[model samples]
Target: RVDFTKIVEEQKSLREDFNKLREDFNKMLLEISELKKGYGRLERRIESTFNAMISGLTDLSKYAGLTLEDFTRKILENYLKGMGVLPSDRSLRSETIDSEQIDIFCEDPAIVGEVTAYAESTKEAEKLLKKASVVRQKLGKEPKKYLLVMTTNKQVYKDIQKISEENEIELIVGRVV
Candidate 1:
């Protein structure tokens, strides 16, 4: 009463089903791999586009004959003037003394500042502090105000802001460039 043929046929069917499942799993793995590759490509493309845009904007700024530092200096001067911290007639300008360059300096009101397109680290804040110290040492007096002016708010990190606050450095962001 044993049906060997039927048992063999059942075994063959099970093997076929197992093979089909394995093929399906392999296909799914390939699809997942392809999706990952596609995502990587898209991420790279977006980064490239962003860099290109920034480069274009920099070129345009150059053509306009105004560097980011110059633009930031004008904005800071206007702001200080409005606040009555700086005189209406006194304008900010760069000066180099004792081989140290001050990006924005005013003698009478004793304002010392540095300008940058973006501030992304505490190092920038520390650099301004060091410059301020040098100016104080050279001039034999502390400046009335220390400033760090940024043209773009795009990359002003929290650590930079905190350091500026703790060190009593006024961090001002004019506008996005």
Candidate 2:
């Protein structure tokens, strides 16, 4: 006599295994999707690196475009006037340092503030650090904090945070507008 009932149970086990295989396939598909996403990110990094390595950018504004000094002045004036950071007793001299300018120079009771503003770029973090170093050297004592405002792009917010944390400097960015 053939054990048909036992054969049916084996078939049921085989069907369960098939379902498990389908779930594994779906998991593999998700992993593949994630890998593709990561690869695309890497491709973008390579492209940006290549562009950075290229020559100077052409001027559309005929050399009348926004300069770093202009940006620094605007940001400092707004912060001092609107934010009450500037003092009437002492003159406020705002300048951009090659390094983070040792934040302390910006904080002297008589010195008002030292700020560096940029339009935001890959070079921002490095520039901020440089300003910090200069401020430190100039002040002999570290300033309370370094204020960095970027009018160019807010995409570098995370980068600003990272550098600020690493250097223990206060980094502020301009609004998206």
Candidate 3:
């Protein structure tokens, strides 16, 4: 016959093990909660940092009276410079190519860019296409052509996208205030 006392002892041991497991699970939950809190704090800090940077940039823009077009032009120039265009090449001092105001023209990478504040009409895309054609003629048929617009509606943006694709122009939209 089996010893009933031994069976009772085994049950007690099992209960102890289950209690320990419950305690460990609770501890893990608490640790996860603490980690979530820490992550929340980190996320807020990052958001605040970006907001401050944007505010600083906005203040500088206001001080310089930079319109949307001007701001976009500046961004294009900086982007070209970042792409390895020299300061002298990216300078606005360069004469307007073909008696038309070309936005950004870098000889090294052979890129010509145009900046517009708004592109809400199909006519805008057409004009940009014409400009790209001229730039291609000047910079050669294979040079990179870009049109950077500050804002556009969804429908108009689609139109512009089609035109750019057909004309082999890179249409970039900048979401800037």
Candidate 4:
């Protein structure tokens, strides 16, 4: 009761449809593989960029004659100027008051500051605070206290920040531009 020619034609059409779908599926798989390879390449590039940046920062820190204090002061000087807080008279004294030296003294603003190359420990932060306290005592005035640190460790930085806040000290963190 079935027509033989019609049945044969239907079988041929079905085979053509299957072939097209299989071809499309293979193309999709190839595209996905290419995308995966591209993603891998992108991830490697990002990691390489980060490593290069860290190395560059390390090299910057090791450069001679540009101590952490010097670097922070250089930046702070510009910042003060921008804030219109320029010192009418800047004094740099090497004299030690109880083994602590005031790194910078601004006459007009009566600002005293301590600078450190690296703040890697709470001990270092305490040392800076002690220096500020000593300067205040020697100056016999409650001069605006400043702590400038080039911090390499996150935990130390946090500790320093907390100490600075408690002591009402202005903390300036130096970093690579």
Candidate 5:
């Protein structure tokens, strides 16, 4: 005789097993969705942090530049005073004339100069020469001296030095930063 009870019991067990597997798969999907959301949040946080760091760095760079300009101006003033080019009361300063900004400028005994934290190429020297030319054109008189001061320089210092000499731009370098 055929055993109908056994077949029915086996079908019930198979149905239960299928239900359990489906439940487990749904739980795994939920976990994967939560992980994806977490990953998105983490990405946003990292991007925000990176942007903040870049902004802070930019501000710091500007502050450092202004500080260096002040330091260069003081040194140039003292040196020129010692050399008898600048008067005791007069001071070197930054000026903008006809939209051209001069990093270092003096009225009496005309002088034009630029200050940089670091210079790696001769183009820097050439740029200062061009600025001097613009200042001369705007003022309708040639400056007595054109100066290029750098806190540090790379291997191209020799080429820059040559350009400075040929163009009569006094190059002054302090200890490397």
Candidate 6:
């Protein structure tokens, strides 16, 4: 016979796990709050111009279950498909963590998705641009699918525009994080 108390204990364990998850989530929220303290400068500048460019929730609590990379890849894949740039069959590559790292690589077209994910700092943005350049160089003189750099930071968009025009790289940026 099944021990009914054992089932009750199992339920208690599940509740404890959920409670731990909530604590972790709240901790992440505090971290994000601290990071965003001085990031709103450009946000204020572009408030008028890209008012419509930014859509969706300013607070991302609904996505608490998702990691930054997961969130970025999903948003990117959907955004590319939405922009009619990438094929619907394309999926993000995640397993390989190589020196020449790429977030998502399209198999058929061989496009590389190098997302910056810089909500505050532009260091990640710069690194992605450099990596994308190196990847392009490694495949020199061959036609390649676009290497997209996606970021939520407003400041990076300016840099992206300048770089795209200079190097002829394609970039897709979502306005609101």
Instruction: Compose the digit string of candidate 6's lDDT tens values, residues 1-177.
Output: 368889999999999999999999999999898778656766555543433332232125146676545665676567668767678877756423347676665544445655543435545446555655555565553223233333455565666656556655555544534
Deviation from native of the Cα of residue 159 in model 6, angstroms: 3.2
TM-scores for all candidates: the values are 0.57, 0.39, 0.52, 0.53, 0.57, 0.47
Instruction: After the best TM-score superposition of candidate 3, give how far the Cα of residue 128 lies from its true spot, in angstroms.
Output: 2.6
Model 3: per-residue lDDT, tens digit, 1-177?
A: 268988999999999999999999999999999999999999768645543553455446667888644665565566556766546444432236677666666555566666666676767656655655676777675556777665677788888778888878767764323
| Candidate 6, pairs of clashing residues | none
TM-score of candidate 2 versus the correct structure, residues matched by position:
0.39
Per residue, candidate 4 scores C-alpha lDDT tens digits across 8-33 of: 88999999999999999999999999
Q: Per-residue alpha-carbon lDDT of model 2 for 29-146, expressed as tens digits?
A: 9999999999999976864443232111212212657554444444444445565665644334455455333322344542323344354553655655565556667666654454
Candidate 3: give its CA RMSD in angstroms. Answer: 9.5
Model 2 segments beyond 4 Å from truth? 1-78, 81-86, 94-107, 110-122, 144-147, 152-155, 175-177
Clashing pairs in 3: none
Report the lDDT tens digits of candidate 1 across residue range 32-139.
Answer: 999999999997686456445544554466777998667556656776798899999899899986787889898777778876666555666777888888778877
lDDT of 2: 0.52
lDDT of 2 at 30: 100
Per-residue CA lDDT of model 5 for 1-177, tens digit only, reads 257888988899999999999999999999999999999999768645643543344346566765757656666687689989899999999998767778899877678887766676676677677878887886778885544444344566677768878888776654233
lDDT of 4 at 89: 46
How many clashes in each candidate? 0, 14, 0, 0, 0, 0
Per-residue lDDT value at 49 in model 5: 60
TM-score of 6: 0.47
Angstrom error at residue 35, model 2: 42
The per-model lDDT (C-alpha) reads 0.71, 0.52, 0.66, 0.65, 0.71, 0.55
